[model samples]
Target: MTTLDLDFVRSHFSAFNEPSLAGWSFFENAGGSYACNQVIDRLTNYYRKTKLQPFHPFPASEQAGREMDAAINNLAAYLNVDEDEIDLGPSTSQNTYVLAQAFLSIMQAGDEVIVTNQDHEANSGAWRRLTDRGIIVREWRVDPETGYLDIAKLDKLLNDKTRLVTFPHCSNIMAHVNPVAEISAKAHAVGAKVVVDGVSYAGHGFPDVDALGADVYLFSLYKTYGPHQGLMVVRKDTREALGSQGHFFNEGLVHKRLVPAGPDHAQVAASSGVTEYFDAVHAHHFGPQADASKRGPDIHDLFQAHEQVLMAPLLEYIRSRNDVRLLGPENPEERAPTISMITNRDGRSVAEDLSKHGIMAAGGHFYSHRLFQGLNLDPEAGALRVSFVHYTSPADIQKLLKAMDAVL
Candidate 1:
């Protein structure tokens, strides 16, 4: 069986070599990943040479536009979606806010949008605000004890008036991977649009949005080892149905329809670096394939295989502790490598304590505060989240475990 080359992977990120980051084992990757060298180089180059308005007639502008176009082209290919379906904006929160307006244009007063307690506030808050416009918002609550969202509950919520069904691909705190394809199918059958917040899951492995059948799939690139931007896949039909949330003249433009916030050209251009990193990884593990959709799934599998290897022992060690309660699945294969534990002490305090031992992690609501309430826990108490990605090494995990033991 092939295993991820950790040394080879870590070399692609310059953060590993930084004197400031030396001796610190990062475990708060769900918050944001350290940008890869590919992305950094692209950003620096863009700022130095082509830091001008894009899509214009001038050379620098043309080059800037080309980089942005290549970014969309490359990323869309990797996500298994068409170029026009991709929308790059400031952040996932802003992107979804604009998208809710699109939905508002299409939705009637009595239409219902299903949300989940497990989603980050970025995905939850905007849609919930639709209540002010008379749109019915339904919540798919998680189990108070386990923080698990049952699909059976969602089945009852799906009906003719269900205009949209919004949920997370995986919770930031819980780390469980929701069945996006299955949920999409159910929503589609009811003539409802599926909006998946893939913010947590995309960091682990970008999904096949085309196959997943989500009308709007949202995730933060910053969390996925790229620039600080939100990437979304808005299906053609959904875009047309909701119409333009941008200027009236831009209604005909596929990319501009929902992106009223416009785009940061440099960051958008840097996105290609993420795809390039994935390409390099794919070619290293398995010979190069021309089709990026093929590369998308292949790279996804490679990432997951490596993550499961890292997650197994960490999960076991957490579950063994009687004092702390682990959220989400008990098995490594069933969830992303984000482990959130509710201990007797405040999670933030635990994180602060871990930091003293050179373990970089976080504790707090993590913008998923609603989840704490749903799980019958106090939001102020928060949950200790120790997350990692492909770039993390076994040595880092060992350091985290030792620090965590000392802190807790």
Candidate 2:
């Protein structure tokens, strides 16, 4: 695979050149990423030219509809799934909540579903509520020391009665990249479907959703250099068995089945910019491909290769520190670049100290309070998070280390 061109990648994000954002290294990417220039330009263009309702015969309306369709198709191509299998909702929280209702529709009083402490609340909360409906909600917990969900533990949790299994592709706090394909295979053998939450993982690079073999996949577009939209991919085969949460009139449409609320028009239309941006990066590094779908794995490798390099020095620095405790896998290769540490002070105060040195980071439970509880830590205090993605440069990492020396 071709190496990632950092300067070229940085050029695609306007935030790097923004006056107020200058001199600051961003480490809060797990919260949300800076939208690339393509997404931004598409957003502004939509607002300026096609502010009208879409799919009508009038020019602006027709153009608006075209953009929206293109967005879905292009994004689907990159995800390696059918166009109708994709749903773009308001956010991951909303998408998962409505989806749980669909799951509930197909479930019985004593049906069993599995959940995890290692997942963000968006992925865990709505499903947990099924307990009120008489569904057996079993907890597949993380290893407190590693903050990772063990596949062996999942094996123990799985049996003939297992209906569904929901877990994160990577933990936001620990950053351990779960073996999704392996987990999916185990779940399938027990006649269960797996909902893989790719929110914390997708931003680093878009995985081959089809290859992961998940029955359903979810991720946040806002964190993937696109608009504030949540993407849910319900495979053609799996969605056939699930119930719809959409309007009775729209039950025929697969994409509309899970999204109960109306989508944001401009945001949906502008989302094509994400694929456009990815195409540019691919062309820059590995030249052109006839299909964007084919580029998913290669692009994933390119981005992850770059990110792993960025992770090396920081992991080394954290290893040398006696005062700092790094959560998740110690090896950068085993996890995402989202590093969280617990120190003497509370996470918030330490984040405040780091901010004084122009390092952009935050400290909080980050909606993984259950994971903290599993680890015997105070959710209110939380851990300081310093995360980065492919766009993060060596200079930015160095800047962070220099500030770490001062603050820690």
Candidate number with greatest lDDT? 2
What would the TM-score be for candidate 2 when compared with the true structure? 0.99
Single out the weakest 10-residue window by summed lDDT for candidate 1: 236-245
> Against the hidden reference, what TM-scores do the models get?
0.98, 0.99
User: Number of clashing residue pairs in every model?
Assistant: 0, 0
Would you list the C-alpha lDDT of every candidate in the order shown?
Answer: 0.91, 0.92
- Model 1: runs farther than 4 Å from truth? none
lDDT at position 258, candidate 1:
81
Pairs clashing in candidate 1? none
Scored by Cα lDDT, where does model 2 land? 0.92
Clashing residue pairs in candidate 2 are none
| Model 1 Cα RMSD, 1 decimal | 1.0
* Prediction RMSDs, each to the true structure: 1.0, 0.9
Over 4 Å off in model 2, which ranges?
none
